[model samples]
Target: MRYLIMAEGEGDGELLLGRCAAVEGLFTDPPPPPREVLVLRGCAPGVRAEWLGAASVVGRTESGFEVWWTLVDAEVLSVAPHTGNPALVDVTIGAGVLPDDWHRHADGPFVRFELTTGRGAVRAVTRSATDGLVADRAAAEPLPLRLVGCEPAEPMRAALRKRRGRHPGYTELWSLDDTGRVMDRRAIGFDAEWTRPSVLGGALVDVLLSVDADGLPGLAARPAWRLWRAGPPQRAGSWRELDAAGRHAWLMLAMRRERPAGPDRSGGEYHLAGAGLRDEPGLHCAIGEALLGPGGYYGWGWDALFDSLCGGFGLVPPFTLVWHDFAATERELAGEHDPAAGPGYPEELARELEERGVTVLRA
Candidate 1:
């Protein structure tokens, strides 16, 4: 997939940075997530962790350590001593009690560790690793990125040569297909020095870079993660061309790119190929494709889905959702032993859609 450097911010869409290839970072296996130190202000006095890397203490490290947290049940604020203080880390945790709610702790927990795994947020990661990818390079000038053909506009290139460290930050890079059609857009700040090559024609080729975007790492579940690294599809129906794993990847990529809200199909009937509607993510991928075509963006979670149903995001309400090959599950979408919101997710999903004036046809 080819990529172009567009103007900073989403304001201007016409600007382009020409074409390039052999891009890294965005699609590549992300380096260890930048560690984020969880500062527990107004924490309790006796709060502590069982061990340094304990689940209740440090949480999930970005390096792939695991923890046990669920919606129904709980794992355990399960911390410390990474920096110092070998003192036994003690803490109390309950099922369904998450770290984000650390502030809610009645004892006022003092956080000493961080979830390096970024928890589940691909973008927002833990801070045990300390300095951030971009933050560390803050004082660094120019750019450490070396996109294959990162040729800026003539005017922009001239500016770079005249001023060594002039324009940086919020450098917008748009992933494009072979035909130069934009597939995805990412705005990442360059936190390094950009040494302009002496040659006029030569694009600034100094330093290597990494793209720290969402859904780029820790996707062992999505077998077809490479499908996403290839970038968005040229046309729609991207879901149709995907396998089960690819379907997951499609959702990952789709979640990053926000499709603008426009007029609905005007009370249209969209057919969903619901043959393998196994998980919630799978259902979202198929339904989004059915309504908004390939690489579509309807909503991932319940609250987001409600926003989509309200209107503006592609197909407004009053449309029919023909969910083919439908089958209801006995247990909730959550796994065994985990807390469940209901018996199954389908009924809840249907109830939400129908309430919003959507016609759900289960086939």
Candidate 2:
């Protein structure tokens, strides 16, 4: 959900990444943030240096107990003999360390680290790998993607030219909703380039960002801006006019809620009109309208919905939510996310409301 890029946090940055189909890493799960190396003394002999692939290694106890480690997705550096004691091998890792799983493979070696379990005392001479520990590998470089468009902002253009491609450094970017609400912001590292905009038909999009990552936030599914650009919905059941994708876009906008300027509007007997309920998004749209008139946002998704029940969203808890025609609404939202297990969405929501001190009347 990229709005025209705004410099810093406000005003136009005068750049358009555009609503292109999902870009790898750009929208989806971004790579984990870069981290420092974590060292674990008394990595224990139970760690199988033989299992050490070209990338990483892990230590374990005989019973297969888990490690006291943090970084699980780590790169294996080497599996050479301990410099001090040639008999004992050391498995040096980088980027991250072993996983701290509650239970590991029963047959695998029980793993432990000195930082947590070891407590600074030397446990014992570690067990030896049947095959000697002997693996050394250099880290692979991150592959950068190329961007071609009407050039980036002044500062971004300069950075691209200066770096020419390697380690150009990172910058913070924000994901905006249709209403220009900041959904989320992330500091991403990118290697940019100056290239002719790829022309298809008669459209042009600015492209000046590229980076490698595992799982960062933002860059969610693109929205159909036409809905909000015409202005916020004013009539009830406005969500019914759009197709499923548009309705989902509406719910997403609700999820990226605008911070209420004043105190929240809580405590009410909100009446929900279920006449237009045909899908999950319709339910959320109706709820928002029921809570705070048309085009209002209470919350979207389970966690956000629960938080909305607490307070701050347009309408809050300690109120009565009279859901009319709920039977039809339930049918529309039945067996969602999973038809095989758990109650229907309506019941789930009712339970959540009841727990939060909201009275739910289903009709």
Candidate 3:
């Protein structure tokens, strides 16, 4: 959306600039100029005013100063500013009719205008929408990823720092203890940043063995970042040698699989082609029936399979998930069984089982 700003009387430019600054300050990351602005006229009629409120304001003019402000929907102005100047009245201007061009613009609803001048001269100017504003802004600026309250192991910390060095989008690390004690912090980047809870959790698990082997007892991490903890140190040479919990955790870190991205008609584990039938409907029906049968919980999805392995679905321990005709099953589940699609169910189920200290096998 676009908004027009015009000045008519003496000191008009200064007034317009002040108004623009006030409006721009509302956004945490103020957008660039020549961009759409939303103006609230008297009462902001017909507009949702939940984030707005009205108040009177006095500002310097060419003569001495002026006291004027259009009444705004109190509700709409309430939450408008992210910080500072709780008084929404400071950002408002005197009453004026919306320009005729406002209705003509294709993105008219989003565009607004504010004319700062002597109360008498108000004119409407029409112009085409400015192309590339949105794309230009996005390309010029990318959102950052902020890491706050991080207390990673030394190696883990180095790894995180390395990632930040490689990616300019990562904000400076905020080094804090697990108990929310701040050791060091740095400010960089705008306020808006993408946060992925899983990223920290995954990192913690990757360095779990190191933390334990160093004899660092009482080691704790932020609950939100501790997705999976490492099991006790083990010297199991094979899956059968480790205890149940150790085995589960090992498998979780080892096995992982990815599913195909697109649709395929090769059929899944319960397809009827293996039964010598070529009918699609018959195959689908058989597949559905098998999914509802014993040990069929795996058919539901990754979560269900994990639950079954943990005996959450009443399945006993010493569970062995044998993928009969492994290659064919892989082809059906992960289109053509592409290795790039990932380890598929094995990886997913193993992770869940490991989290819960449940042992299971995938063959």
User: lDDT winner among the candidates?
Assistant: 2
lDDT of 1 at 312: 67
Q: Show the lowest summed lDDT stretch of 10 residues, model 1.
A: 131-140
Off by over 4 Å in 3: 1-299, 336-338, 346-363
* Candidate that beats the other on TM-score, 2 or 3, i.e. the better one: 2
Worst 10 residues of 2 by lDDT: 115-124
Error of 3 at 363 (Å): 6.4
Q: What tens-digit string does per-residue lDDT give for candidate 1 at 1-363?
A: 266665554565455534455454454433332234333222223444422231333334334443332222222244333233343332323322222332232232222333221122111123323221112211112223455545456534554564343335356667654445555566654332454342324643432443344323334424434445455554655455555455666665676665665566558788887665555666777677788777777886566777877776767778888877665331323332112224346666788789889999987
In order, what is each prediction's RMSD in angstroms? Answer: 10.0, 13.0, 25.8
Model 1: lDDT equals: 0.48
State the TM-score for model 1. Answer: 0.57
In candidate 2, position 230 carries an lDDT of 47
lDDT of 2 by residue, 1-363 (tens): 343233332354333322321223444444443544433333345434222211323356667554333343444455565656765656554553322233343355544433211111122233443222222222323443333233245555455456463233334445554555555444545455543344432344345455444324323333423445445556677667775656766776555545557876667688988766776667777888888776777765556678776666666667899989988887876533244345677778788788888998987
Predicted model with the maximum TM-score: 1
For candidate 3, what is the lDDT? 0.27
